[model samples]
Target chain A: MNSLFFYISEAVIGMKRSIVMMLISVITITISLFIFGVFLLISLNLNNIANSINSNLEIKVFLKETVTKTERSKFKQAILKLDHVKKVNYTSKNIAWKKFVKEYPHLNLDNLFENSPLPNSFTIGLDNNQYILNVVSNLKTFKSWVEKVSYGGIIAERMQKFSYYIKILGLILVIILTIATLFIVVNTIRLTIINRQNEINIMQLVGATNNFIKGPFIIEGILIGILGSLGAVIFLKIAYTFLIIKCNKILPYIPIVQNKLEINIILVSVILLGIILGILGALLSLSKALKRYSFNKVK
Target chain B: MIKLKNISKYYQSNSLILNNINLTINKGEFVYLVGPSGAGKSTILNLLLKIEEPTSGELFIDGVSLLRLKDSKIPYLRRNIGVIFQDFKLLPKRTVFENIAFALRFYNYSRSRIRRQVYQVLDLVGLTTKLDCYPTELSGGEQQRICIARAIVNNPQILLADEPTGSLDPETSWEIMTLLSKINMRDTTVIVATHNRGIVDDIRKRVISINKGAIARDEEQGSYNS
Candidate 1:
């Protein structure tokens, strides 16, 4: 126990000697993880927006204007009977005309025509928004002379492709940053080990074991890792908050909703990531340091 | 209490450092090892210190065979034997007090005890005022004295010093020799290895001479005749 205290004190002194190098390491790690954390936050928000769009998507089935009232009623009943159909609403020509005027109140549509020229349309809603593509394809087989069946699958497909690219880029960034962080940590700790090499040699001659010699260095690495991770977490929080506020203000056309639950989730994930990286960095450097130094052969 | 029977240590494929060495130093016995350069004077210290194993032989300390001991048990053996070197290998960054206190920490000494013992040893070596001085700030003689204080801080049963006065002048060397003699009188086996014929002739102690890695002379109250 007394030996452990001495070793810890020695580690602190060693770190103090290279305080500038230690700060550089911590800053590098924080920046790397911050980049990763910000990318994750953006991707998560994009995913949430895509989900909201999918839920509100509607499949529109236009009908032949020449159809009679009884045929339309039968067609509507058939759609409501379908297994996947959630709701069915038939828009008459008058109702469609009224909605068009409501959308363009200042356009003075009353001067254009005596009677409404808009055709009656059937707006379809599905039980599961994700299945709209398949649902629209099935609707095309209806016997009510379906003019056209259109769903938001095309836009959804494009968004999905974009999401794929974002994920790939995020992964690549993480790989590059992780390798760079490890390299930086390994080199810094290596310099530290070199500075104390003679002391280590003397300790070995005095019958210190491999564990005894390595304990201080490993502890130093761990401390650095922890501090770096904390810095990253702080940076992530600031970035996430800034993004949420800025995006909400700039992109008013697309409603941006910040889910408090998701923010909590990402915050927790970043904290855990910081801890894992800290421990990993320590363990990685220690393994390399031990290989270059053999306790029994110090003399 | 060290026993070496037919111990022979060789280097590479042909060169030998120690050949068929048989010797025993009883408990509380002080002995001086005198030899020219490359005569295995340090090799004998290295073997007893268990830094290297013998090529063929049996070595026992307190009836425990060092050659057969596991690596984990080596530290326990070393705790009983304090070692000092010719270079005064005190850590340059540490103070005189810290250097000595470091040895006691390994033995799990309490903080108060470590402080008291370190100061005691510093005073014994006449370095109480220089306790906070770094090795680089001290003279060659003072650094060597600090090394001696560090070696004896743990109160080991055996003290193995290799060419301790090799870098010191006549007066300082004699002072070191007197200190070792005083330490030996305290029932700690002190083995000093050196090539200083002047000190050998003056001390007239039990001297073991080595030539070409083999013992050539062993005499009580011996002087430098080679």
Candidate 2:
């Protein structure tokens, strides 16, 4: 307990001694972590939007009016059994006509077609867009019952592919940004260690153990990391709130993850990430310093 | 309490700094390592501290062979030995008391214990009133005194002073030597390396004179010359 107090006091004194350099280090860490947090937030919202769109996609299978009722029921059962198929809703010709007319107010069914020309159809909702082609091919195989099988094939496929690419790009970007942040933080701590070279030498010469000398430095690094992370998290929360409000006003159709609980989770994660980065940076620099200016090497 | 057997140190393959040296100093002995510059006085002290490993030799402090000791055990060995340098290597930013306390803190002594020990050392070095003064704020002699206080604060069995008064006047040199003698009287083995002929002649303690890298003379109640 006494040693713990000494280590903490030493770390505090060290921080005070190099206040300007430490401030620079903390600010650099804050900026780096904040930028990384922004990237994470963008990627998360993009994934959420893509998921919503995929869930809303549906395939329409038109049936021949001459098909028997038993065959129509079998077709519905087959679709429901297929992989990725979520649910199937059957619509009779008369209901389809009513829905069509409701969708297009100017259209008069009696004028457009002599007698309800709309055919019975099955609206197929799927769990995923990955099996869209397979489901379409399977529906087309039932030639006797299926008159036409149609889905937004080109658009849905493009959207799915785009979402996949976005995820990959987001991962790559986060990795690069994290590495860059680590580099900056490590260098900053290195400079702090170099500034305390003399003090370190004195401590070593006076019979201070390696752990005794390194404990305060590690604490200093952690403290700087926590301070930097706190600043970044606070700034990110405010910036994210502002961005969400602006985006809501400008593009309401864009589905964003706006749950208060989720936002809090992200903030907490950012703080944790900031701390981890700080510790990693400090460890890297301290090990380097130890290698270069070991206690035994002091003249 | 300190023993060296056939100690040899060489930076280059061909040139030796300390070659085939052997020496010993028992407990409570005050010995002066008298030599000219470059005669390997500092090298011998460095060897004892294990700062620079000897090319060949065995060093034993209280029967523990330093050469065979693990790297992790070096700090523990150093705790039993106190070293004072020619430049008075005190932390410039720390007060005199902190400088003394710095050594004790490394050993994880309680705060009260450290404070008590630091005060005791401060009083021993006759700087009890200068506890709060920084090294930069103190005179040359006073700074050396703080260095002494820091060195002996741990109550090390062996105190090695390498040119402790190399930068002080004759009177200050005598004062530092007197403090060292007082420490030696308390059964601490004190080894001072110096060419300060005045103090060497005045104190007339045991002297080991070195010329080149070998011992030229070893005498009891020895003076500056002969």
Q: Which structure among the candidates has the greatest lDDT? A: 2
Report iRMS (Å) of candidate 2.
2.2
Q: A74 in model 2: Cα distance from truth in Å?
A: 16
lDDT of 1 by residue, B1-226 (tens): 6899999999888799999999999988888898889899888888887877899999999899998898778767777788878898899888888888777666676889999999988888888999888899998889988988988887889999998899999999999988888888889999999988999899878899999999999999998675
Instruction: Report the Cα lDDT for residue A160, model 1.
Output: 66
> Any runs in candidate 1 off by more than 4 Å, and if so which?
A1-8, A50-75, A81-83, A89-131, A138-165, A252-299
Clashes of each: 0, 0
For each candidate, the alpha-carbon lDDT, in order, equals 0.80, 0.82
Error of 1 at B1 (Å): 2.1
In order, what DockQ does each candidate have?
0.46, 0.49
i-RMSD per candidate, Å: 2.9, 2.2
Task: Estimate, for each residue in A1-299, the C-alpha lDDT of model 1 and write its tens digit.
Answer: 77767767877887888888888878887888788777777677667667666766898888886688888888888888877899998887788888888766545686686777877789988887767767787888975567778776676667767777898899899889988887787676766877887776666666676677777877777677778877888877776678667765676435444677877776667666655665566567667665555433422
Model 2 misplacement above 4 A: A55-57, A60-122, A125-131, A134-164, A260-262, A295-299
Share of real interface contacts recovered by each model? 0.46, 0.57
Clashing pairs for predicted structure model 1, backbone only: none
TM-scores for candidates 1 onward, in order: 0.83, 0.83
- C-alpha lDDT of residue B81 in model 2: 85
